[model samples]
Target: MKNLFTAIFILLLIVSCLSQSTIQYIYNPPENIKDGLDVGTLAEVNIDSSLIIKAVNKIYGGRYKEVHSMLIFKDNKLVFEEYFSGHKYKWDGDNHYGELVTWDRNMPHHIMSATKSISSACIGIAIEKGFIESVHQSIFDYLPEYQHLNSDGKDKITIEHLLTMTSGLEWDEWGAPLSSSNNDLVGLWVHCEDPINCILERPLLDDPGTSYTYSGGNMVVLGEIIRTATKMKIDEFSKKYLFEPLGVDSSTWAQKFDNGVIYAGGGLIITPRDMVKFGVTFLNNGDWNGKQIISEQWVEKCTTEYRNNKGINIPGQASGRHGYSYSWWLKSYPKSGKKIDMFNAGGWGGQEIMIIPELNTVVVFTGGNYLSDVRVFNILEEYILPAIN
Candidate 1:
């Protein structure tokens, strides 16, 4: 009996140690600041002095109450950073809606559609390294298992269409419990014996690349493409190529797939700081600490406006003006009596990486407003933008 008790105690100790080790692996922070700049507390430059106070007041006035995290970087320096109420250090439980409910500053938040932008970055890197032949290559080439898709126009789908949200696949962007196509995809991903085959069975709604349709299915297909091209899982590829180099370590950086295939569309969960690092990498034109993570050509192409759907009514629109790039949103900011070039990687529920190249600025926000007021953009335009200048 004594020997058995000792053995059980040793096994318990081993299990405890393993659990702690896994947690440490997931949430490890950088040993030190990479640039030696505390991005949370950099001084703001007064580009337009008049707009400064007004912008600060607007943000502080509780207009965007659900905005939990905000960070600003200007001229390659950290400017302003803050965390608000409804924010916690980590998500502890799933909400009644079945969404994860962590809000900690150090905890990785659900980036929502911002995952699309990050996934695009992975594709860019793959193309740069010759892992992917070209963006023009048909996605079916990578996932030949999908080549048997019988839906008309499905064979014509290419990487370009998937990246640009122009595959014309019958999918709904909004994950309404009753109406969203994404919910169906999620169900299929969870239950299907062959997930890629299930996704390939989605019907094509229109001619590929001719019309734009926001579809998470498009990104899911891209995830499969990445899997085929690298001959490795997406999570492993991101950790080796993107996250580790950028000094981002997240415990929740995983896909829910059985094979741990990282969802290229929206499965990543990264902290606000890590998300800022991603923005800075892009703001630096894909260079991380003098290493070119992605080519400048790809960055320009990914951020530049590729499609214009006039008067399209989408969420996060200011005056209903919006444009789409390769997994990025293009917005023209009016400053100093001129329209400045700005683009953002935005996610549902107020997650954003707003970049203004002319001003050399980037603003990031992460929030829990999954089904709240859609006024964050107004707060950004009216308050955040003005404060930075």
Candidate 2:
């Protein structure tokens, strides 16, 4: 009995050590980039390095059971970049029962709601190129079928309202059948033959711009609006204006249904490295490698909190320690009783692109937490943030 106990204890120790090593492996900066540029030389930001390491360790030890990647950049140089799991690109097509998946630098994973941020960027580009008239323009102007609806108050809805998630259109963001009636806009993407028509048909639950409701329906509507205004498919416009410029050419955009439109709210697949590039672009204020991809004005407007959802001053809200800006989330914390501005692009599961503009820093994290786990955020706040310090 004593020998058996000793063997079991040794086994547990080995498992624990292996787990710790895995965490370190994922957080390690990419070797090629590290050799080319020193992360320490990137910029001057006061971060506790030990805290950052602890944060990374905690996240990896948590319940997220999929590939994870992160990158931190300050100034114009790469500070940190790394990947975990031999499974870099874990898609529906790649995962089969008991198959040993090997993922590396080039593997692409589904980004989920992070796509909303990218879609928002596309809209900003359209606005800068004169395709979109203004944020105040009536949405019906782009989708004329919406004009037939007896939506008197709805007509007052503007592009800004939708971008800020204050459109007041009824929507249940949480995918609960019991909660479906809270927002009549549920299943618009999956059920409707015409997404634009489905969105226009939703009944107004409150006056436009009066409340805050997180709506995937709103994002689908924005995608339709971009398609109409630009007279191009969402995927094409994204490629020409956003992806190609960033040198990210391998990502795939999945549609909700066969012969249907791309799922603009969440269904984008991209590499972890490419995801970092997207965050870095925002950190650089919409420029990439010396070229202006998105207008500086658009970046400012989209990142700043545009409306007060209910009583919540979005940027001042405590939920996720962030505020809603267009499709981005503005994360801030009170330092000495004053709110400091930080922002992030987040997705369902554990995908995040956190930016601290004051520090000229950007961090990206991706994982598959889904509904089975909620510890990923805890890891971010308690472990990841401390490690960067």
Give the per-residue lDDT of model 2 (tens digit) for 291-343.
Answer: 99988887897678756742342221124534678888876654445655677
Screening candidate 1 with a backbone cut-off below 3 angstroms (N, C-alpha, C), the clashing residue pairs are 26-251, 88-103, 88-104, 89-104, 90-104, 91-102
- What C-alpha lDDT values do all the predictions have? 0.69, 0.68
TM-score of each: 0.80, 0.81
Error of 2 at 84 (Å): 2.0
- Stretches of candidate 2 exceeding 4 Å from the true structure: 1-28, 32-48, 63-67, 86-103, 175-186, 310-321, 334-339, 374-380, 383-389
lDDT of 1 by residue, 1-389 (tens): 99999999999999997775444111122223553334433333553434433443444455565677766677756656556556432223332134334345566777877888888988998888889999998777898665668457676878988888888777664445412334665565656666667667777777877787677767777877888999866777778888888877772545566755556777578988788778888888998778888789889987776755333456543435777888888778775688877778887667888888777787888876654554666766676666654
Q: Among these predicted structures, which one has the highest lDDT?
A: 1
Model 2 scores what on Cα lDDT? 0.68
Index of the highest-TM-score prediction: 2
Where is model 1 more than 4 Å wrong at Cα?
1-44, 47-61, 87-105, 175-193, 258-260, 308-311, 316-319
